[model samples]
Target: MTQRKRMMRVPAFPNNAKLFALAVVLALFLAPAPARADVTKTNVGGTDLQANVQLVEYETSCRTTESDSDLIQGIIMPRNPASVRSVYFYFPGNTSEDAAVHEGGSDPERVCNPNTDGKTQFCKIVNNNQQFAVVTFNRNDAHTNTDNWLDEASDIQCFLREARTKIQAYNMNPSELFVSGHSGGGKQVAWAVANGGVGFSKTIFWDACYGTQCSSTAPRDNAGQMYLYYRAGTDTQADAEKAKQENSLKTKLVETTLRHPAIPNGCFLDPSNNDLCGGRGEEKGELVVGTVEPPFPLGLVFDETQLIIQQPQPRITIPGLQFSDPEELRQLIVREPDGSVYIQIPFLGQYLAAVYQWAVAAAGIIAVLVLIFSGVQWMMPGNVITNILTKAGGERQEESQNKAKKRIAGALIGLVLAVGSYVILYSINPDLVEFKSLRIPYIIPKPLVETDEPVDSIPFSALPAGAPDPALLPTAADVCFPLTRDSLDPRRGISWNWGSHRDGSDSDACEADSDRCHAGIDIYSKFPGQVVAVADGIVKDIRHVSRCADGWGAEGAERPGDGIVIYHRSLGLTFNYAEVDEGTSRVQEGQEVRKGDILGVASYCGMLHFEVYQGEVDRFQTLNWCPPGGIDVTERHQCATQNYPRPDALANPNDVVRRLEGNFCR
Candidate 1:
């Protein structure tokens, strides 16, 4: 489709002296005077239409910190503030380094002094023939794009507060606000509506409504109306079509979305392949005329003579509707806990799957035939009957019958055992066979195969019901010590000075600066052996954390290093060990471990920092515990001793060391 050509006449403004005088007159009689707005026609960004640019002073609540600036300069268009019935707000795409972080240009100013080089998506939107008062904002990078501020509810409130005042000032209805954007800006618009409490009357997108995230089939609070103008053959179209596939949850979801009832006339706009609809035209920048009907209703009257310009392609909208986020679309794809994604099979696939049941029936018939043949041979008097009929064949027939009867009997027994084994084993643990669905048509090609990655099998049920008997404990020759290749005592290069960095420290020995101090000991092994779990437990977590020694390497110099934490539910304790050699962890998280099982090698700094906490592992916080001091926090865990209670307060490991003495070489 092509755009209708029209000669745009740039509005002329009065001289500076006359404008100054008019400003003074308005200030004295009307209301508090804000910066005077100006009307100027200029080429903005990459648009073919000469945009009538205007300016409005705006400020929002978003900032880097409480002390930072909140001022924003909004770029507007058409110059006439009074003629607009609807207010359209837009966010710009990714900004440059100079625009994202610097505060030099952040002061309040007239919005059209080209705060962003005048080359932005907002410029293209504001330049359109639409009569709505279009405005776009400028914020620092932290408040722009994916910094989370775009999704913040407070930021939206700030914008609406300022927008409402501006709309009222222009004698327009604030509630008639329409929000829209291009690309990243569109994402912000969707996120803002879903999370922010403000309800916009309408939303429009320009080749930006994307992914399941930007469009939704459900009604969002205060944001139930929307329109999408997208390019054909774009990723956005792919996502939309995917959502509309047969038997898809999104197909049903679209039905529930807000829609306009059947059109008064059966003719809806077709926006297919409207390239000239959204691009800079030929030399002299004149809009080319196209005869195609606009895909979406152009509610605004353009030049009383013409009703069309190149309109955007693939126009779609849910009428009387509000926009919703894609995340809100439930049942789009059902996921099982085992990490398999599934969808209800289409009718054809279901029928095909159901047809496989005949195979199972055929196998059952074979088993019955085998049983019948064996019974017939066993019941018949084969040798005696054959001898009466034919003397020569009696001996041979008897021998053949005996062998065949035995073979048939064995085959029948094997078939019974095979079927019985499957039933029994499946009843015991179903994970061995991962089925897609338990519904009818239960026979289907497997839906998906989780990676066949081989992993160690250590089921918790396989562990002894209680702690093993003393005789079952590993001897010195069977296991290596944590601090040494041999014994764990001081004479064998191990530390006996336990709790060196805990409560007794006078600030020098503590690794962490917090009041709790370091809750466990450090094992500095010169020739460290493989670090092993001291008891049956589950490997809870594996992380790479920075190793900071005192104040050195405390900044960015510190980096992620290997670490592991195991939870021993039987012992009511959790053990965290760090500084493991890279790529040496043989066990994965959630795997069960037996006593003295090698967890990983101790490498790099040769210093393994270990900490033990009581009770279940709190995945959120891994703070070390300390003895009850003069600290004001009442919930602080006391030192692991006889004086403190069990479970909440950690237990000392001096006794645990003694129990593992025999497992380490002396």
Candidate 2:
């Protein structure tokens, strides 16, 4: 159907005009932010990577030490970034410097051979620094295969921490970000997942990942709540190798992850567009959008509004063709880990221009289809048998002249009707949307190839389980939390999930509408503090509580009055008794009281709201945490849907409780 015109008022993009002004400012400050030559930074060759016109590079501080052999060489592609969220450390393919080192690996210069080429193109390809270093170690040919797996897992943690420090997004920020890599990079990343690590929100390892403890590998332990992806070729020669490594890594990572403190989302990608990646023998490129002078947008909304305006790079823009250094380039990859922010700019090349050449070819195909169909209908037009004569116009005459006249008149009428119908339909309907739902295939008049029919399939149980599905997901107990066998105390193991709950006006400065602030810290009465007369005043209110998950906000809100509350006239303090399975408050409401007395069981639903009030007012108001736009505190909670199993269903519930009580991090 023809598209109806939508009368939407074009929004005023005030940000656009302002952004254009900034682009002008950027063009002026296109040089590296450094004076003469400084010793702290590396002498990364000469190119002002952020210049407005072309690819330029500048020197970076590559002065850190690695492996204790020589000073570490770091080069950066600096930019006046809008806001630096991440940094990338790229280890280009095995360095030629590696080849020069002997079995002794005794290169004091940290210089051996250069990369095979001077103009080296780089990509992260691997998920994290851990896997990258592990792969690098194997390249040394000195370490045993056993070290690879463990190195993969732990290195990931190290890499994540180090990358964060270098990025300097915030000096004291403790946000865990992303890791991305390729091939051997893919293999390294897979190993990281298989072996697991302490931190890192998520990782993307493509074309690589190995089986557990291959000759002494970590059986894929300690992984975070990661999203695992595997894409392999079906008919290609390398299919076996790709599938083997993928399955191995998948098996190990999945098994260990499901039972671990955190379970990651594992996805074996569909093979439909199996060749999406630059797999062996596959097409190397495809058509994509190109920008001549792309802007680094800040608060430049991409969805809905397609307005393009030049915006100056807040941190630094790589300019037309180059980055300030390698660090800048690596930092742009998305999935630096899950929850972290990243962006990728398309590479400039002649090959890229070729992808858009199809604009003309497509037009030619439509022209040919239309011409052939029109020619067939021009002759013989309507069927001779379709005409029916009206009494007012004519009658059947056996004469040859009458027959000829009838055919001609009928043809004219039929042609007129068909043409009229096409025009009227065209006016009502126009361009169609890419709605796959309504599309149906037209029947082809070509021969059909025959194939043999197969027998009915057997039951799913008849087939062997190739790889296990992720463990039944944790219920709602908040699995992303890092707890261990030593932390939880059953007497008061489960507490209300604070990260999920929020109130307004915390004594601590916080947004009034956040859900991040904890209402109060909950803990079991492990030491049993003495309870006495709450105060000289009468009790204000008394109520028992239960699981907030199931029976909250109802008359059952205070059942059988398991707990009690106490009011102190002199101190203005109200102490709540909570989670007692059953018991009337021991003291009378108006009775005089003293120091120590038994309160109630420390329970989740059954809990206390203890506050110090002055007269009728509480000074503190609890509020949720509201991070600035685009930055997500919720990002870290990968297993938001994850829940703890029923206490009795846990394999080691008691041990888990200890871990939960004590487990401080993920």
Candidate 3:
């Protein structure tokens, strides 16, 4: 806490000759007001509780200008200053030119101040009725104005601590706290509640709902509550959308404020309507906010006729301000019950166990009482004198019969009482009753029908007349044509010379005058087919077309579209294929694919961008076939045409296709 010097009051001289006296009076009025604290203690007229109204004036360290003091003047009414269970601090909406500390901000006629008029709506609805205290503070030295109270949040926390310390002197439950505000003040209340780190019990917003963090904040604990009430007619489409998103954080419903049947006061328009409230219950024990958007001035009220309706838990709408008449705002706050009170009942086994225990205990007590009564009857026999003259044998016989009858009756009565007690205990808590030796049966399921059979291989006899010989390839049995038979026909389709080409460039390596290197052959077909896997391999990587759509290369470089990399572990080689139609990459990353399996359908980019790499090739950086030294076009073409070792070239994708019969032309 920052220390402040107190200015002492000096006596004024009336004599004109005393020039020093006039100077002192002028300085007091012109200079900044001294920091001070004052308290007014009064007794509530009809109640035992006492009200201690306090005024604390302090200068905040935050300042942007040389003339800015950033002084905060606050008025606090922890209604019963001492022993408060909770506190509600309200931040007002409007602004004023001069400081509110020196000049009272509220108009005597418009704003309610219980100190001046005890009959004010604020006093009736809040201070006088609720057990918690209420405090109203300004953002700075000036009148309440901007909703940017978040700027002074740290300073406000310091002030709150001092207030808590003062109230702690008289209150036992000083930890319980709450925050509220209307309009701009409400935004401040939200920032304080969400980011302030204080464990507030509840927060009430009246005709104010706007906060950057409002969409993410939630109640701190099970007992914490948040209520957002605003006029619907005054809300814009954007405001409604923002409100919906914020309320969704706590899974609440936002609806137009309507007059509910349960509220004693129907609609605000009706003359007889007094109070309105309503809320729907929730099952998860989470925060439930019932929003009603009524037009401004003639605002909405909640009609809370019943607390909880049916199944799940009850939706309880805590009391909120009626905006139709701002002066008619009512105070309604309902503290949530602790979560431990709701317990689920146990099933069959538990119920039977409780019953057995209860029965045993009841039977034991009843048997003991019966034995005591029998002993008393045996010791004190009636008609002592007349029995003594009669036969001793008849007395023993009569005693024995009575004893037997008492034993039977006591046993029967004990059984009945024990049975009745068990029944009652089971009804209350079925889980407590336990059944011995109970078994639950399990049902066995039947087998499922087999699905589609796997296609492992395609016969070479299906290839066209000019297809390359498969026997010359190293992995002849494993290789399969990449495209379907119909799309790879030799006569109608055109397969240009095998080479490399920088994508989207007009210079093709296959052309004589071109300077570019075209790494793969361009296969043009009017009717395309699904591109199958070259051999049995596992999918290594898959880059979808969405990546290229986001501009992968230089400014105007064409997108090679969706592509896949397959790793043939046995052959120690990798196959790269791209420019497949969207959603046609049948093989996913890490998927195992067999020969002749559909890898994807080649369609976009005019042709497929296919490449092959040897076991030691660096697929990512392998590009030019020519070395750094001077090399003619003939040598570069020779290196690209055949699969050979070089500084730039690793393997030719076209040569692999010819060697493995993947190419239609021999």
Global lDDT of each candidate: 0.41, 0.28, 0.41
Model 3 ranges with Cα > 4 A deviation: 1-35, 41-72, 75-79, 96-112, 115-121, 140-153, 172-175, 211-213, 216-224, 236-666
- lDDT score for residue 426 of model 2: 57
After superposition on all CA atoms, what RMSD does each candidate show versus the true structure?
Answer: 33.6, 30.2, 29.2
Q: Is candidate 1 or candidate 2 better by lDDT?
A: 1
Any idea what lDDT model 1 has? 0.41
- Model 2, residue 518: distance off in Å is 28
Which lDDT tens digits does candidate 2 get at residues 173-213?
A: 22333343322334445444443222233343332233321
Residue-wise C-alpha lDDT for candidate 1, range 26-134, written one tens digit per residue: 4433534374453333532233333454445554444422225435545354555555665767654444355423221222232232344323333333344335566
Off by over 4 Å in 1: 1-52, 62-70, 75-77, 98-130, 141-148, 209-211, 230-235, 242-666
Candidate order, TM-score descending? 3, 1, 2
Worst 10 residues of 1 by lDDT: 261-270
Residue 493, candidate 2: how far off, in angstroms?
Answer: 5.0
| lDDT of model 2 at position 95 | 27
Greater TM-score among 1 and 3 belongs to: 3
User: Could you tell me how far off, in angstroms, the CA of residue 26 lies in candidate 1 after the best superposition?
Assistant: 38
Clashes of 3: 41
